[model samples]
Target: MSGARQFTDRADAGDRLGETLRDRGVDADIVLAIPRGGLPLGRAVADALEAPLDVVVAKKIGAPGNPEYAVGAVASDGSVWRNERAIGGTRTDEGYFEERRKIEAENARRKAERYRGGRPAPDLAGKTVVVVDDGVATGSTLRACLSKLERSDADRIVLAVPVGPPGTIADLEAQVDEVVCLETPAGFRGVGQFYANFTQVSDEEAMAYLER
Candidate 1:
């Protein structure tokens, strides 16, 4: 299928992906979404599988002088996943990373509190966690999320997305137990390019999805 026709939005994509997993008898342990965009998609998957949905807040740490270029990402649990390759080579300074970490950590905390509403995170012990996102570009955020989840007591980690660059999907395959990506295009531009109605997901909307 063409990338243009793959998903109406993150929610629609999640529905189709959930159906596919059901067909394969993959009830993927627990649903974890990267808010705030991933929450709506997570809700659809949770409803489809009759599973619980929770948020995994991770902030991308962008390189100095280039906010769009991610050097790493940090999870809410204080887990930091760094791309050593991106460092030093891209003129990324030492003190800059430390500063970014502090700022991103605070941002992640606010997002967690806003969406979770003081709700305790689910115990991942002995459970298979399915991590969902609206889409992926460089996979930096997901890399950190999966790294954090791996340190947890979860049995397995499955990364799911509606669409992503082919290279990003390949890079994640080794890190995740399973990857359920609907579209991996070589000519990928951005996540929004693939969706017809890719509006920004508000924190309020994300909270409502979690409450459901």
Candidate 2:
């Protein structure tokens, strides 16, 4: 039998993650979630921890012919994380990266506006900040988000994801103060494969969760 269990959805995963964090003494001043996908999970965590929920957006820069192949990713504030191995071997051009960055930058801006509604980003000055995501596959996007958080005045930066591949988790541990992942499989294929009901999360649904 496979070791993997089930999560009804991202929210359920987040709820369990919150409890695990609490047990592990994950005390954060605020929870910033990567938007669209992570917002719902963030909501559950924020509610559990009684912390404010904020939004952070990351857009993946996929290689040509393989949209799922994230060679790199960019955060809302223009921080970029590239997989060196992917970049060195792939046929991706500088022009492709530039073009993708332009499109992703605009997409990030639009998401920020829609999600935050002109509200200023949370003041992380000297406060512990936990960045939550549903799961991570390539680790490019999570690295981008963590890189941007490092620039902030946060006292601590914790990356909380429900599931990830074992190798990805090890790499992430070298970057963040703490990495909270529920499952790390050696034969991990993708994040959705671990979930029972892994469905696309619409921006409207994300906003609705934030509104409440």
Whole-model lDDT values for every prediction:
0.84, 0.84
Where model 1 places Cα greater than 4 Å from the true spot, the runs are 1-5
Against the true structure, candidate 1 reaches a TM-score of: 0.94
Worst 10 residues of 2 by lDDT: 1-10
lDDT of 1: 0.84
For residues 86-118, could you state the per-residue lDDT of candidate 1 as single tens digits?
876787887888889888877887878777888
User: Model 2 lDDT vs. the true structure?
Assistant: 0.84
Q: State candidate 2's TM-score.
A: 0.92
Clashes per model (N, Cα, C within 3 A): 0, 0
Question: Pick by TM-score: which candidate is best?
Answer: 1
Q: Over the stretch 1-212, how does candidate 2's per-residue lDDT look in tens digits? A: 16655678898999998998888888889999887789888998888888889887778888888877888988878888887678767878888887887787677767777798778878788998888989988778778888888888789998999999888899999988999998888878888887888889997888777776
